[model samples]
Target: MHVPDGFINTPVSVAAGVAAAAAVAVSLRGARRELDERTAPLAGLVAAFIFAVQMLNFPVAAGTSGHLLGGALAAILVGPYTGVLCVSVVLLMQGILFADGGLTALGVNISVMGVVTVVTAYAIFRGLLKVLPPGRRTVTAAAFAGALLSVPAAATAFTGIYALGGTTDVAIGKVFTAMVGVHVLIGIGEAAITAATVGAVIAVRPDLVHGARGLAAPLKLRVDGRLVDAPAAAAPVPAAARSTRKVWATGLVTALVLAGFVSFYASASPDGLEKVAADKGIDQKAEEHAAAGSPLADYSVKDVDDARLSGGLAGVIGVGATVAVGSGIFWTVRRRRTDEPAAAEPSAA
Candidate 1:
């Protein structure tokens, strides 16, 4: 849900900005541990993929549609900290470039869509993994459930935020009920997308999937009629599997295809938040986006006449810019982690 400007008051918006900033700061530090050579680039791809998939809004209800929130998918594919950053990156790009999300409400969107979804979904995912039998199916099932819940969780969060700082006078209970109700339908779509994507990645490169990392049970040996943990073995990494180039290229191509062409077929109805806001009078005070003058505003090129070409070009540009910026940020984070000085071993007495 891209919260537009004027939906929230200045003080509450600023407070949300501070909270979002703090969360990002913490995530950046946590991401240092999560990012590595293999994952850093893949993380960027995940962000780009999320951006692309979000463009394809599926119909959820009569007048409302839903898009991939990307929190559960990202957390399952990468790590939670990086997942938050991934969604944040997409939000940033959409706000500044596409003029989709409002600049003034950037913090509110990030807090509700990025942090809340990632935290809630990842917690549920991990919890389900702990209880469910370990397997690829289990991973996918957990991801589905996590994603299913994350959408409504984010909607509930927005409802709470609105109760605190909503610009218009509306019934808090009505807003909450509507937001959660519509988003619950949206969550079904989210769950399907997340589960399918996670399953696909796990099938191709389970090594790259952070949540699926430990699926392979540790070897056990029976000695003297007692079971003992076998010594860890260094499995040989295939040259092809070791290189993420193929996977990266494949993912980028998929994102390009989706955003550039497939997006044209996406549902044109308002998304869950927009529909809810309109129904509940929340958009009465919504202000125009600051970037409305941008050439690429509203996901269309300014001078391009052909609707398909303009929209496609804008989508391609968005995907390219998002990947470039996301990759740069993740690469820098990865390098910072690797370049740190190693702890020196203590000298023998």
Candidate 2:
């Protein structure tokens, strides 16, 4: 959930900002191993896809709705460190461009939505992968569980933050109960989305899936009432087959359609945090977004009378902008990875 201004006090918000900055700096270095020539560009696509899917909020309860938070999905499709950066990019874009999240609370949103969710989901996913059968199914199952639990975990984190620095005086117990309860329901939707998306990608090009790398291995068999190791499967997939321009183009097209058109049919109800705040009086002190006056504030283009067209255009613009910025950041990181070896060697004598 995107924490808005006036929800958390100045001190906690600043601390969150510092924490967010540090995490991002560390992630940039951590992402290097995960991003190669092929995967670096894919990282941007992952960010763009997350931004698109997040627009399609599904109904969770009578008045509350939830959208794909994308931490687990990103991590499963790419890598954990890159996943954090991907979601953070989306948050920054929403805050400055769409006014979806408050500028003052940017760090809070990044810490809770980006850092907390990615860290928790990735840990659980890796842990589950350890015990489960190594295959596509295991990866999909673990992804579902990781995504399912991360939503409530994020909500719980927000509750704690509120308890410490909530602008309004309220019952921390009630806030925690409501947030955790509804978010648990929301987590079901998150699980479904994460599993389906991860499954689809893992099916088409398992090699492209960073988290599913070690899952597939030599075949095993049972013969003569005894377990036996089968011969190793066919030779490894060629690099040419792994990262094709056609697949990347198809993925980008899919993301564009989801955000630009499909989002129009998404539920209009308030999401988990908004519903909780409205119900529990936690939003009493909520302040207006600083960018409320922006042309594209509230995800609608200024002076666009057609609701569907305005929102669609905004969504498309958001997807494009996110991809561009995310790709730029990842490209820079990839270059760092490329340059390290040359710098490590002695200069020409």
Candidate 3:
């Protein structure tokens, strides 16, 4: 959920900003180890896709809706570090260009939405994969579970943060219950989207999925009644996986379609956080967004009277801008990945 300004006090907001800054710094370093030629470019696409999907909020309950948080989906498709950066990029774009999330509460949103979600989901995903069967099925299953958990985890983190620095005097226990309860329903949608997206990619180009890397079991042979690992490397990379342009183009097209057209049918009700805040009085002190005067404020292109055209144009612009910013950041990180550990193909992930 995108925390707006005035929800938390100045001190706590500043503290969250510092924490977010440190996490982003560390993630930048970690992403250097995660990104390379092939996967580095996909980072942008992942961010854009997340931005696009988030616009299509599905109804979760009466007067409540939910959208993709993208942490698990991004982490399963890319790496955790890069996934953090991807969500952060989307937050930044939404804050500045769309005036959706507030500039003052940027850190809070990044901390709860980006870092908390990515960390929680990636941990669960890897843990599940370690115990389950090693294949695309395992990856998809882990993704679904990871995504399901991450939403509530993020809501819990917000509750904790609010307990410490909430601007209002509302009962934190009630907020906690409402936030977690509503987000639990949202998590189901998140799980389905994550599993389906990851499954689709794995079906065509499992090699492109960072979480599925080395998932193929090592070859084994029976010699003298003793099973031993084969000396040969694993399976060969399919031609589809080797060529990055086709997949990249396909992802961009899909993102465009989702944001530009499909978003029109998305539920118009408030999201989980907004509903909870309004219900619990946490939004009593909420302040106007600093960028509210921007031309693209509220995700509607300025000077466009047609609701459909304005929203669609704004969505397209958001996707294009997010991809550009995310690609530049990831490309810079990939260039500085010279000191990483050796690998068969650094970019293949």
Report the candidate with higher lDDT, 2 versus 3: 3
What are the per-residue Cα lDDT tens digits for candidate 1 across 1-349?
8999999999999999999999999999899999888899989899999999999999988978999999989888889999999999999999999999889899999999999999999999999999998988899999999999999999999999999999999999999999999999999999999999999988888888899877955558999999998996688665335989989999999999999999988999999999988888999999989999999999999999998999899889989998999999999998878766453445569
lDDT of 3 by residue, 192-273 (tens): 9999999999888788899999896665899999999889756865544577898999999999999998998999999999
Clashing pairs in model 3, backbone N/Cα/C closer than 3 A = none
RMSD of each: 4.3, 2.4, 5.5
lDDT of 2 by residue, 1-349 (tens): 8889999999999998999999999999999988888888888888999999999999999978999888888887889999999999999999999998889899899889988889889999999999988889999999999999999999999998898899998899999999999999999999999999889988888888888996776556999998788975479666645655766788899999999899999999999999999999999989999999988898889999999999999999999999999999999999999999999999888
The clash numbers for all candidates, in the given order, read 0, 0, 0
lDDT for every model? 0.92, 0.91, 0.93
Query: Worst 10-residue stretch by lDDT in candidate 2?
Result: 236-245
What are the runs in model 3 whose C-alpha is more than 4 Å off?
217-241, 339-349
> Which residue pairs does candidate 1 place in steric collision?
none
TM-score of 1: 0.93
Candidate 1 at residue 317, lDDT?
A: 92
Itemize residue pairs with steric clashes in candidate 2.
Answer: none
Q: In angstroms, how far off is 71's CA in candidate 1?
A: 0.8
